[model samples]
Target: MEKLLISACLAGEKVRYNGQALPISEPLEEQLSSYFELVRCCPEVASGMPIPRASAEIIDGPASLVLEQKAKVKDNQGHDVTDAFVRGANMALQLCLSNNIRFALLAEGSPSCGSFLVYDGTFSGVKMQGRGVTAELLTQHGITVFNVNTIQEFIDQLPLVICNQSFINADFMK
Candidate 1:
């Protein structure tokens, strides 16, 4: 079976910044398990962040800028945590490379794992159009990334990919 990288919280791991887990519905979980081996990760925790830590967001600019070292990620408490976010992203990339994983299902709106959108650094519940640190890095490396809301799309594409024994390009899916 092909492998799929996933956010730990989505798999019932209590590793979120608020120390909460957002496990998917049991039926959906079973459906995913039937298709691929899930490799779970909590990038923030893996980067040595404590559970119940203050929420962080990409500050100064978008995550792309952060990846380029021109921006930063800061917690709500006004502490810089850019390095930890980037480190966790690198760890996620390495895990995908070593595991031959081509797909990721990460938490949306997270500073580390959000694939489609992330908080806008104001801590006022605003979101911006952009990828998070890990999502941007993984997509750059040719991995297909999906967030919780887009799992159905991933499932829809799985048959074509598995039957052809090749990874489907993100473009083709779009």
Candidate 2:
């Protein structure tokens, strides 16, 4: 079976900053289970942040800028946690590479996993069009990242992506 990297919280793990698991619909879970072997992870937790940890946001610019060292990821208490975020992104990237994972289903609105929209660095619940650190890195390295809200889009594009012989014969869309 093909492997899909996923946010642990989306798989019912209580790994969110508030120590709660995000809700996952039954259909989405069924689709994921049918299509791929799930490899779950939480970048914040992987980076050593505790459950119910301080919320963080990208500062100065988007995750690309942060990866370039031109921006930062700051927690609610104004602590600079840029290093940890970057480290976690790198670790996530390594996991994908090691597993030959080309697709990722990441949590939305997160400083680490957000694939499309992320908090606007103000911690005011405002969102902006931007990818998170891990998402940006994965995209840079040829991985396709999707937010939970975009699962159907991901499924639609899977056939085009899995044209290679290794995945062409797999029962990925069952």
Candidate 3:
């Protein structure tokens, strides 16, 4: 089975900044594991950040700017956490490279793992179309990132399979 790097929080690990896990349904988890080996990671935790850490968001610009050191990540308590965020992203990239992981399923709206959209640095619950620090770095290194809402797209790209007498093939739709 192919190895798929997944956000630890999505894999039922309590690694979120709130010390919570956002796991998918049991059946879906089982199905995905049947097809791919899940390699879980929490960039923040890997970077030595504690659980229940302060919530943070990229400030002033997108994740690209954060990677470029042109922007910052500030926690809800108004502390600059850009260094931690960047460190976590680099750690995530190292994990991908070492594991030969080509794909990732990250938690959306996370400062470290959001694949498509992240909180807009306001702490007001506003989200913007952008990748998070880790997501942006992984993508730059050629890793395909997916969120819960788009996992089906990844499944659709898989090779044809016959399971329990049912044909699972995206090519048939084409």
Candidate 4:
């Protein structure tokens, strides 16, 4: 049996910065409900923050935010949300490494769970190439994290017979 590390918001939780849940495909939702166990997390919440909170940014880099206090998630209310993002990312990593979690499905364009195109924190929807807080941490620990669209691609790469699959030097070239 395999387990999936899923963003809690994808499971229809109201944990997004604005208190909305992202769209989840029904098949994937059903798959999660029936077969695999989910180690769900909302890094923003796990890190520390109330729902319907303000938004923050990774001003320099996710790592820099962790080091300094700049990478923050602030709402329009002018609150500092650095701790919540950090705390959430750390907890997700612990869950991934300490448990049997190998694959993670994250939310894209988020300050906490964004996979590839995170916002520049201006609320202008200007996206830059970056990893979200929890996405970065989980990836560093060897968990393969992806957004919903990439899920099938990852699955397709796995051999149907994982147990007896064999590889040779030629396989690496392709």
Give the whole-model CA lDDT for all candidates, comma-separated.
Answer: 0.88, 0.87, 0.88, 0.72
Compare candidates 1 and 2 on lDDT and give the better one. Answer: 1
Alpha-carbon shift of residue 166 in model 4 (angstroms): 18
Best-to-worst order by lDDT is 1, 3, 2, 4
Candidate 2 weakest ten by summed lDDT: 165-174
- As a whole number from 0 to 100, the lDDT of residue 68 in candidate 3 is 97
- Using TM-score as the yardstick, the better of models 1 and 3 is 1
Candidate RMSDs in order: 2.1, 3.5, 3.9, 4.1
1-174, model 4: which lDDT tens digit per residue? 567889999988888878999858888777554435677788778766778876776664554455356556554556666677778888988888787677789988877787787887666769898888778777777777789878766555445423322321223224
lDDT of 3: 0.88
Q: Which pairs of residues collide in candidate 4? A: 47-87, 47-88, 48-84, 54-75, 55-74, 55-75, 56-73, 56-74
Candidate 3 deviation (Cα RMSD): 3.9
Worst 10 residues of 3 by lDDT: 165-174
Candidate 4 runs further than 4 Å off: 32-35, 62-73, 157-161, 164-174
Among these predicted structures, which one has the highest TM-score?
A: 1
Error of 2 at 43 (Å): 1.0
Which residue pairs show collisions in model 1?
none
lDDT per residue for candidate 2 within 51-78, as digits (tens), equals 9999999999989999999999999999
